[model samples]
Target: MPERELTFAQAVREALAEEMRRDSHVCIFGEDVAEAGTPFKVLSGLVEEFGGDRVVDTPISEAGFTGVAVGAAMTGMRPVVDIMFGDFLTLTMDQMVNQAAKVHYMSGGHWKVPMVMRTTLGATRRSAAQHSQSLHAWFSHVPGLKVVLPSTPYDAKGLLKTAIRDENPVVFFEDKMMYKLKGPVPEEEYTIPLGVAEVKREGDDITIVATSSMVQVGLGAATLLEKEGISAEVIDPRTTWPLDDKTLIESAKKTSRVIVLDEGYGRYGVTAELAAVIAEGAFYDLDAPVKRMGAMHVPIPFSPPLEDVTVATEETVFEAARQLCGKT
Candidate 1:
């Protein structure tokens, strides 16, 4: 079969469609899934094909629907619930953190909530505070939830497929800025297992570990660093909860310096988590303190320039890496 390229949004829709077709118990429920098909149109045309019973549309009550989905998952069906914005996940924490995440462990291995909570994270187009937040770290801090953030179209489809098929609750975060991003995805069915990191670019001076939208910025920084005769290695964890610490630590050890970038706040966020892991695991290998670049500790501003300054960008990644390499 011929391989076809697809946008990140298309890849997600394809994965959900294929999974629903393969498993009768697999159903999707979320606000606007039936008509608006989500703000990114990830569920576009799904209701028409799968019917309303399977591709359900819920009310604006995120907490209520989240609990309902958790109950459904524990009973028999596998429900993929969409919460629209990553920030809104806070509203459903009761069901997600207490119920869905801990059900399998609380049941002593007798039962599990094999649910996928789909959400979008990023600060593009000025979505503001309520809609623009990267809460992957929050979910990763919890014990039972599996967090996956895919940077490429291929990983997005594959990881999402894995999340839907896995025997645990998975929090799948897609960056809104990357929805229209294009890449080559397999024309056939495939799945990228969680907990594996991809080395997007290889270098020797320093390792840059990033997630979600920061991956693109990291790559761009690597390009600029190369021109300055500094070789920078870039690693994408792909999945946040089951982080590929081994790969990341080894990369940092090889380079002897590191820069961790994220789209979330710096304090107690994914960047901090990764920095702690590298510091604990590869303390001897580091020649200097690991640096982190992230959004400022403030709500995403509506002003484009202010939003640009607050969020992670190519310049931010580059300058941080420069400081780590003693060039700044």
Candidate 2:
């Protein structure tokens, strides 16, 4: 299969279009998703291709539309519900946590809520506190929900397709800052299996486990580490829930040093969870403490300078790696 360069948002749109074409049951609904094509224009022109019936533009009611999607999924429709902003997800907690997530388990496996809840995360676009957030950890803590945060265009397309086909409710998070980021994506059909992790770069000196946009930041840090003669391995846990612990544990065992990075708050966030998993599974492999880096606990500010300080950057990651390698 030949590969072509595509932005992260374009890859996501391709996945949605391809899945809708493959399955008559698949449909997408959200605020401004049809004619307006979303603020990012990811769904631009999709409504024209699929028609308004399949590509719906709903009222600005997160709870109402989310509930409708859940009900539709129960009746055999694969509905992709888009939450324009991660903060808006708070309004649909009942539909997401209680109903959609637990329907299959509550029904003794007789029913399934095969739905995808896609939302944008991260800070840096000056969207302010309401629109900028990395809340994957909140959903990951829920048992019945599958949490996925894809870092690259390839993973974004493949994982989203898999999420749409999944039998369980999937909370698919997209880093808002990565929308224009481009990468190679094959034209051929493909679906990356859920609960799997990918090793973006292999090394033996230390390991950097990152999520969403942090994966790119970690890779940049690894490049700097290389100049200092430090071989830093990079791992992206594509899905937060049912994380690919095997790959992470093996990498920790090989490197014996780990730095977990995320865009969520550092306190009790996804990085903390990854550190716990590594300590529990590979406690004997540790040469030093597992360092975790994430955004500061303050609300994301609208000011560019303050926002830059709040979120993790390549320099922050690079310094974390240096300190772990005893070079700082």
Candidate 3:
């Protein structure tokens, strides 16, 4: 299959189109998703293609539409519910956490809520504190829910296809800042299994584990570190929960130095989980204390300068890698 260049949003739209075509049971519902095509326009023309029945536009009530999606999934339909912003996920916790996530387990595997909750995260769009936030950590802590954070176009498309087919409910998070970022994607069909981690770059001096948009930052840091005689390995844990521990633990054991990066708040966030995993699985191979970098513990500010300081950047990740490698 030949690969073509596609922006992150295009890749996601392609996945949804292909999945909806392949499965009659698959449907989508969200605010401004049908005719309006969403704020990012990722769903533009999809409603025209699949018609209003499959591609639906719901009201502004997150909890109400989310419950409807869950109910639809329970009845053997695969519903893709799109939350316009990550912050709005808090409003649908009852439907998501208490209902959708528990139905399969509570029913003793007799029923399954094979649903996909797609939402956007990160700050920099100036959407302000309410619209811009990375809350994947909150969902990752919940059992019976699969958390997916795709950083690249290829992963975004493939992982989403897999999520739509999953028996358990999946929380799919797309970085809002990466919508226009382009990467090569195959025209042919593919599905990247959950719980698999990818090594974006390989080295031996230090290991850098990053999630979502921070994967790109980690890559940038690795490129700069290379010129300074430091070889940094970069890993992207595509799925937050049920993380591919083998890949991360092996990398940490090989490099003996690790730095975990995330766009979420640093305190008690995804970085903390990765750091703990590395420390527990590869303690004997440690060379230096594991470092973590993420957004500060505060609501993302509306000011460009203030918001810029809150999130992790390539420079911050590079500096963290330098200090860990003793090159600073």
Candidate 3 residue pairs that clash: none
Candidates in order have lDDT scores of 0.91, 0.93, 0.94
Candidate 2 ranges beyond 4 A from true positions: none
The candidate with the higher TM-score, 1 or 2, is: 2
lDDT of 2 by residue, 118-175 (tens): 9989999899999998888989989899999999999999999999999889999999
Task: List residue ranges in candidate 1 displaced over 4 A.
Answer: 1-3
Model 1 quality (TM-score): 0.98
Residue 129 CA displacement from its true place in model 3, Å: 0.9
lDDT tens digits, residue span 60-164, model 3: 999999999999999989999999999999999999999998998898999899999999999988988999999999999988999999999999999999999
TM-score of each: 0.98, 0.98, 0.98
TM-score, candidate number 3 = 0.98
